[model samples]
Target: MDTIKKYLESMFEHLPKTLEVMRAKDELYSMMEDKYNELISEGKKENEAIGIVISEFGNLDELAEGLGLSKVLDDLVSSDRRYVSRQEADDYVDAVVSRRFMLSLGILLCILSPAGPILLDSIATATGLNLFTGIGVAFLFLCAAVGVGFIVFSNYITKSWSFLNKQPCYIDDETIDYLKSEKEECQTGNGMLLAVGIMLCIVSVIPVIVLDAALNVPIISDGVGPSMMFTLAAVGVFLIVFSSGRNKAYKKLLSLNKKVFAREILQQFADAPDNGPEKSVKIERVTGEVVESDYKDASYSSYDKPEQSSDSTEKKVKNFIKVMVKDYWKSVLCIYIIWSFFTFSWGSSWVIWPLAAILRKPIEQYFLGGKH
Candidate 1:
């Protein structure tokens, strides 16, 4: 009974140490189990099989070294309280400010160029503005003013907006411990930048719309409204493209592609303090297993085999497609309703509004619910 407890404890001691090198303990456990089953199939008894499993756990000192545990431990012990780093605060500020400005700019642009143009053309043709030189001149002048407003506002907003210097983040002991143990490093790359941009774009839309309507010249209302909406659409599309590029860049940056990193981590572990009971236990286990054979017999291998993962990834893909399809459907219905209303006034146009009213509810919810 004592031996079993000792063996079990012995087997798990490396887990805590390995936690410092791993992304997730569960992934390590799964990897270990797979290795253990491979060994058992080679005719080793259960205890020997377990021993073999413990023996091949790679270099702990190297892993700890890679994770920078020595620095982490020293920092934790030395700290009187959790203090936020200047860099982290700076990151937060940058993120917030970028987001706010992108939003504000997007809104301003949308409003200044509102989607009233297409409807204006429709109204102009129906009302005979083309034949009337006076009315056509007025319409042209209104468009020119809206175009100038969009350019000036967009430039001003983009230039004036800047990220702040201080931002909020976790500075707790547990957070530091987890980050240190996992050896997971974060790089605030283009994705965060892009995220801030997207959020700002979405939020700015409402404000842009309100401002455009409030500033409308009575006769130029229809033309200005559509112009603003179209301008906003263009900005949103541009931001989406920029955000996508940033994400791609970030992914490429995190692809640690060097073998030297493994050895470096091992060295870091070897230098870490050996004072704590947990640290000592992990060191002993790694030291013991540094020379184990790496073979796994066929019979034991089956026990550690990965289960057939449910098609969850497929389900997620389908769900995304479903959402997109629903959104496309709603947008189509909305456009149809609007076009019908503008073309056919009152009796026939009135029916279009009721139909739009029915379709608009679900479509509005879809867009509003999904917006960042």
Candidate 2:
């Protein structure tokens, strides 16, 4: 009886016309009840009447057919599942904006910082400003132009690039749905990861520019702050390289992160109907085919462990966060390394460089050996 109940439940789960099948079953039960009462009134034994009614209920095929299992099964096998989300799309856009902004900022700052000295020198030479006051005015004007120009130019370029690329783009619901239907085996993907990575590279260049501006101070009075700017640029280059590498790696992982719609397929089964022969035959056939000897040995369990939660709306959000972190780890790591280098050059070098060099033996054994 328990086995029978389990089988019935399993069959019920697979029906597509579940509501109609259940309604028909309920009607059949009602008919049985009425017939049983009349038999009792006609002097048949109660248990005998019950036995006849149970027998008359017949096989499971009638119920299966009533539910429409065939079409649902077909859809499940042919469906392509998608693992992308809006969060990934948005994150990618942010990354692009950040990286592009950073790169442009660095370039502009490097130009502007040195421009101050050249403009001052030109004025000094042209006006014969041997006076301290004349030199100071020329320098001030150059600095002002560089600073203002940097702010405006960087902003303009960032906006223009964004527009040109048609980025800050979003994944439409239709596209997501299509992916879901086309890639039936996997849910996660690399498209959004790539997008975010590109964005990050674009935005990470800004801080380098800001730092370069600060470094452009006339440290030696001659027009030779190029060395400092060069070093800063090198740091910027390394950061960009590391970030780009990480983004590429993450994009690959994201692309590889595929998902099978186990829940959706299972739900299709649960939605099967319980009345009629056509649906019953389809259900039985599909289930047999899905669990057949050869097919069972394959990797179809990729979509296993389907969730039964009613909060699937929330599941999308959680899935997005997971995918985002997984896809952006490289970017994050690059950012950290670059940040460390940046801070060391300007901020922590005073304390860190001497300390690290003094402890070089251990530092080399750890970081150099890749043991850290």
Q: Write the per-residue lDDT of candidate 2 for residues 264-345, one digit (tens) a residue.
A: 4334544655343354344445554332222333322333556567568777776654543432322232343355446634
| Per-candidate clash tally | 27, 58
Which lDDT values do the candidates have, in the order given?
A: 0.41, 0.41
What is the lDDT for 17 in model 2? 32
- In terms of TM-score, the best-performing candidate is 1
Which regions of candidate 2 fall more than 4 Å away from where they truly are?
Answer: 1-227, 234-246, 249-256, 259-372
TM-scores of all candidate predictions against the true structure: 0.25, 0.24
List residue ranges in candidate 1 displaced over 4 A: 1-219, 243-247, 256-372
- Deviation in Å, model 2, residue 67 alpha carbon: 21
**lDDT digits (tens) for residues 135-237 of candidate 1:** 4445544643553343344333323222111211123333334334322333344456445545544553454457557875533444444444445444543
Model 1, position 276, has a per-residue lDDT of 38
The ten-residue window of minimal lDDT in model 2 covers 348-357
